[model samples]
Target: MSARSIALDHLGGAEAAASLVSGQLDDLLIDTDLPRPGTIYRAIADRPVKGQGGMFVRTPDGPAFLRQVKGLAPGQPILVQVTGYAEPGKALPVTARLLFKSRYAIVTPEAPGLNLSRGIKDEDLRDSLLEIAHDALGGQEIGLILRSACADADPDAVAEDIRAMHDLARAVLADAAGQGPEKLVEGDGPHTLAWRDWVEPADVACRPGSFATLGVLDQVEALRRAEVALPGGGSCYIEPTRALVAVDVNTGGDTSPAAGLKANLAMARDLPRQLRLRGLGGQITLDLAPMPKKDRRAFETALRAAFRADPVETALAGWSPLGHFELQRKRDRLPLTDVM
Candidate 1:
């Protein structure tokens, strides 16, 4: 397995980067004041959308669209969680269902159940985690999910994490009935996110200037450009426009018959990390280097496997009639330019 590590330090406020010992930045998070996902807000309902069945709600950030809600009068209070980042100058996307996510546990108010991450397959470990969950939940009706990182973690530490998340969930739920528009919970910043999501075992450097020491600063600086160098001599340019994000694959100087296939496969596997680092999303069109139709299935399989491990929610919309591949990704992270 590739050795993973996280380097965290302040650039403007807070910045963190994850790398796989390949001298390339796998993920980058910069602290921005924008309302982040997983933040709960006690919002006041505004007018409903004409035909979308979603109601607009007033929030500290701006007007956030609350989905799947009905029968809302003007200026009614409701608790909602930010689902993801919204497009520029658009309504912030929100959902009625709230989930409190943390490093080792996730508290679900609506979904009542004790669950373990699917990656935790060891029966003995599962039993131990179940015991810990039962103790922390204290028979609460709310749900608790033990994340994969809890598999081999210290029992006490895991219990503490579970209790912390559970308490936060309870507190947020209690404030749901409060009056007017209010910010209930602030979202995690880059340093917090590094600890919560970069769960792989690795060295951590959190002191001042750790980013420079770990070469994370250099890797992050490269993300400002659109061109991404792929394995072998291949390259891809990731350009974001108002309408969509476009990628162009190039096979460089390789002249072999399988060169296109090789380059395209390399690009597919690395595209998720590139996008994650750069924080680009929404409609993506990939103009791949010319490859055989017979190899399309293999290329698709590679892309699917690559994205399966990515934390971002992306829909591989498949190939267009013009032979370009398409994807729709969530705007979970702000664009690097916006945050940098």
Candidate 2:
């Protein structure tokens, strides 16, 4: 995917914002004033609470829990990165992996094989990055993820920057070790970093009520609607339950056999786009208008082709005995409605 447009709309609350990328509602950022997930913080290690899998840490934001730690003791300063937000009535999940995120790369000292860049497709560029990271780390195991921005950047510049980032991460780690309790080192939230890497700054144009003008607000509202009209004459009813997302395709008022087939084909093409745009995940059951058994294979082929551009991993499990097409997509994050 090429660089896309991004717009940040202030939600009238402190540090709260809504981000739109490529005309899609990509992320919702809520500011709790506490370090959001993906942030690295320093805290004073405390004794593990009884029955809890993680140890307690005294942070500047408040007392937080480090879910994954080793060789830690009370009063010892520890470095932890927030991996997950505190669920309702739950403690935050943190880890010892210190991450340094830039617009084009993510550097970490713990994971050496992890590469997160989606933009570097050229083999030479990839090799160059690996060599640079290897040299910068001085044989120390580290992880580097190059973002889309690095796809066209100068290799030398990227190498220098990665080296600088490595040094910075090391400094931070040293500081966390030396600094005493209650000190917090904040890092960028996941949403902020996502927008930074995916959306080009030059393409951004901020305006009042931009979200509404760009149809972001309307698109979100439409996701909650039960039915969506197709291009030709059919309609699709989407019902998301606890078990899975059920989608029923109907011919509406068009009763002709040809029209029904056409509508089914249109629904087949549009369903995957809808799923991606809405960020719907998990098991999906597409109930199309019943057709001849011979035509099912052709319809399945078309359906698979429609999902060729989807970034999320999806698998077509073939049609069910009841004639519904079954599919499952990996869930990377919560649905749009739940996040909103």
Candidate 3:
């Protein structure tokens, strides 16, 4: 979580309140109600009495949350915009600095990077940065949510946000180097929201104050056909992992001659596309039971031919000493299965 403040010169409490409600303020600005002779103000709503600081408000659509402070002394007008980075080193270092119209809250990391290649270690780098940023903000308002908080988030979406934040930070830092703090990064937040709106899947249904689906209908329709149709009586159990995803196939009651090795090979061949649609990568092992001896060679031949069409880099090998025909699919980002 993060907070920032800006002095809106000549804008009275009513005007500020309107701006907050109308989404004009960089974030929801909380009025401190400082009395001044020429500054006429009125209470538009029964705001919290004690803390002049506004409660945390999630920045429209981004993964970020924000708080606002108001009521600077007359003639001492200033604009402040504070942003909190929650993803640690994953937070784009350069983009986070540009989240303000008056001034950025602070450039901070979300967390220490977890070195996957090395032994697992946890370091609180973002915590240290937030502490520094809080001191700069005069200890008035601060909020924090650990990166672990985003555990269940869609990995693809998070990757995109991180990319965007990094890009914005880079642009701002470049300009600031030449112009100092004279210019402010503006409207980046709205653009982030627009990007999310455009990229979100069509099948997702968003409701107020509730979890919504990710994709739109149009985006999901194609996926519906991507599923590998199980034979008359087989069922599949999916197991996902960062390295690779494994799907278990049980040839249930549908032991028809039609469900022979040739038919099974055909189905397995068609599976690569569905796997791709799910953005599956790394190794995929399909455990299939033994078929009638007569069809064995034919099944092997067909399976090889089918795999030839897959866009993903794949290898189909024989049922192992363990009776599993292993297929390895290369990984890029998080698999689409995890995203969906």
Candidate 4:
């Protein structure tokens, strides 16, 4: 993965734009202008008030509700991440689980354990990266989640990113203490965080009509076309309900001997991408084309491998008795459809 050129084009409407770029053999339709999942913000802590699940603080953006967490006081300034969008006339929910985002890796204050390489498959290299992050942070309570881009990055580069995030967290805290109520210390709005220090100057570019013309339009099309055609001759229909997201696959006209197998494999690869691109999260049920019992194990293995590449944490619960694939992905923000 070389340094790819990124151009931001604002379509027309407020903050309407998309990032057009070819990466890893795929054309990623990223909404660069919108506040995405995992973005950090600086907010003033209002008087803590009891809420359904936790304490709530009113910020300039909106009301940010949290659980009964500590280390907070009324009139105190703090940083938060947009966990989910609030319903109309409802309070927006936020989390203190700070994350430092970069193209190469994401640094979080939460440490699940000593396994710094929680998702990486290579045991030896995992241990090595873990040691690097540990040493770079100097025992700071933080963890690193290397992005797919790190697969080709140098060890030194990874270490540098981890250290940078640690420094960034300190800077954010210092900046928050002096910030006025509802004033943005970083980023374009109180909902977003600025990464001007970490972002390479040469990598940034501006273009008009990128968001409005491309991102918003693409989002409208994706929601309208709930059913998407697969690579070969199959199709997958996405149904979003209040309870969970359900996807059903059909092997259109491909009646070959391995039609079911092929469709299932294609779906395994495409579904994760679709979920990320569309910002779909929480429980998901995939109804794949039926295959022979003997081949079921292989199908599951392929599905797991495909999902392993997702940036978010996903759990595959294997196949259900109804022959559907059950899974869950962590929800960090509103779905793309809702954001648009």
Candidate 5:
């Protein structure tokens, strides 16, 4: 068959992986409820590219795929692909093809109540179903990705699909419903990328190249607006927090008398904008580091004066003996991810 860029939406767990491979399924997509640090594609792709949901592996040989995942909780029945190629594009990694063939893609009443309704209860039901599928159905011990729209899916549509799937499942279940363990259970879906609009952050940049470089510049700008500057001439340390963030300043190489209070004040005054652009929230602390007593007092006075320019409930208490200035701001949401 000619290669096409097929994208599999809710391709559940390990068993699903096996089935797809057995059938020589095209591109796959996976989802995760929690942040994934590492993934399996690295262990299996023709060329794996990490994305938000999971890693994607593609080759001219076949299709790119995504996987679905839930946050790993304690004791959850884990569905790992039992057998597969150690390398990319291998046929049916595990399980027997004859067993999978006629019955490979059947669907059954997987967690009926869960599939039937809305709200948190449905979620619980779905999870329970996944457990049953794994423990009872020779299911490849995989889980499902429940979509938000499922809560609102039309009952008729859901029923129709479920019935069609259940029929197929009955056929498969006949020979091995409770027979020797199988590798997977086909999942439910009229899957599409429609909900991406709601979950993705509009402000966070996910460009192809160096967005990190832009992030660094943005951080420097925030500080500049706060009028924070180096003493001799170095850089600042900024720690982002969910509630607020802290910035530490170190004078680099300037050491000139003119670079004293004027520079420090400049850095302190300009930093807030950078905070906003970076979507930094929470309390902020500034440690100016040690300086000549005279320069310290001047820098402090200049900092207090700058706060008045765009005063927004931001308060800069004069430096502590440790040369730290503290700022507290109320936070309504989480902070940005990039570190400056």
Candidate 6:
């Protein structure tokens, strides 16, 4: 079993918690007062932005811009899902691609398929899960994707989750023709997000004040600072600005010939975890320590490997002309400074 342990407790809200791995702060999540991601809303198209090929929809929260669509009237109602956190004073990001996601299954309303997670490669196991999915779906046109968590999950539990998501999808889809804008399904809170996304086997502590008892709160305080301590006397500073997040790597007190390479590699490996904890995203520019061109491949490999395990979607935009690396990440949550 993994050494990861989850601490679920209240902090400034009804839903807030931290996740620890091997007794160290791995991730922190706090449900904010704003509308949560994945919330399904029956929205009315407000106006179409010229030349952008999109229209603004009056969501339950506020006006949301929907992309890649046409033939939208100002009063037409359509279903949209909250895509991610929006900048302050900006319209909430939303999309019409509605998804019903749970722990073991994800129900795609319009897409139709019975797909198993590729992580489960065993043919017999795949066949068994496929049978369960077929039985649960009962040949519905709605799409169902068995999550990776179902690989070793109990058959009955998986089936139940599938049926539940399927039913929810049907119910929500049925309400698309409603009269006015309304929230059909509220999104998952921080604690529910932890339970749903953190699928690795781990001990869970949900008693009151567990964050304080388990040192999660103390660890959280460190997030206020931009400097992240690295192994072997190295460190990196993450500072956010209006344009993008700037990360500068420093090999403190290490002057070896390979010092820059080592420090840069360490930063690349730990950068994803740090970003997740800090709840920072958008454009990221990394000013790595001075290293030879040949060493950048190693750093790039390490960076890619690090983010492969992160649940959030990130795009590595490659190195800039000035040797700085750039990345674009999803705004899944508010910045840690804003939350704390």
Q: State the lDDT of candidate 6 residue by residue for 131-232, as single tens digits.
A: 999999887677889998998799999999999999998899889999989999999998888889888888899999999988988788888899999998
The Cα error of candidate 6 at residue 204, in Å, is 0.7
TM-score of 3: 0.33
Local distance difference test scores for all models: 0.87, 0.68, 0.37, 0.62, 0.37, 0.90
Tens digits of per-residue lDDT for model 2 on 174-239? 787666554445666434654554544435536766666766667667776879898677898988
Measured by lDDT, the strongest candidate is: 6
RMSD of 3: 20.9
Q: Candidates 1 and 5: which is better by TM-score?
A: 1
User: In terms of TM-score, how similar is model 2 to the real structure?
Assistant: 0.64
Q: Is candidate 4 or candidate 6 better by TM-score?
A: 6
lDDT at residue 60 of model 4 (Cα atoms):
60
Error of 1 at 151 (Å): 0.2
* Candidate 5, 1-340: lDDT as tens digits: 3222122222223111101211222112233222111111111232223453332333222333334433433222222221211222333222111111111112322323222223336666556443433443344322223333334444344334334444444554453323222323432221222122122112222232222322333332343343333434655666664444677666666675554454456566556544543435446877664556777667766666765543134666555566666776533211323211
How well does candidate 1 score on lDDT at residue 133? 88
lDDT of 1 by residue, 7-50 (tens): 77787665555554555567778776778788889999998888
On the 0 to 100 scale, the lDDT of residue 285 in model 3 is 73
Instruction: Give candidate 6 misplaced runs (Cα > 4 Å).
Output: none
- In candidate 1 the C-alpha lDDT for residue 243 amounts to 97
What local lDDT does model 2 show for residue 160? Answer: 74
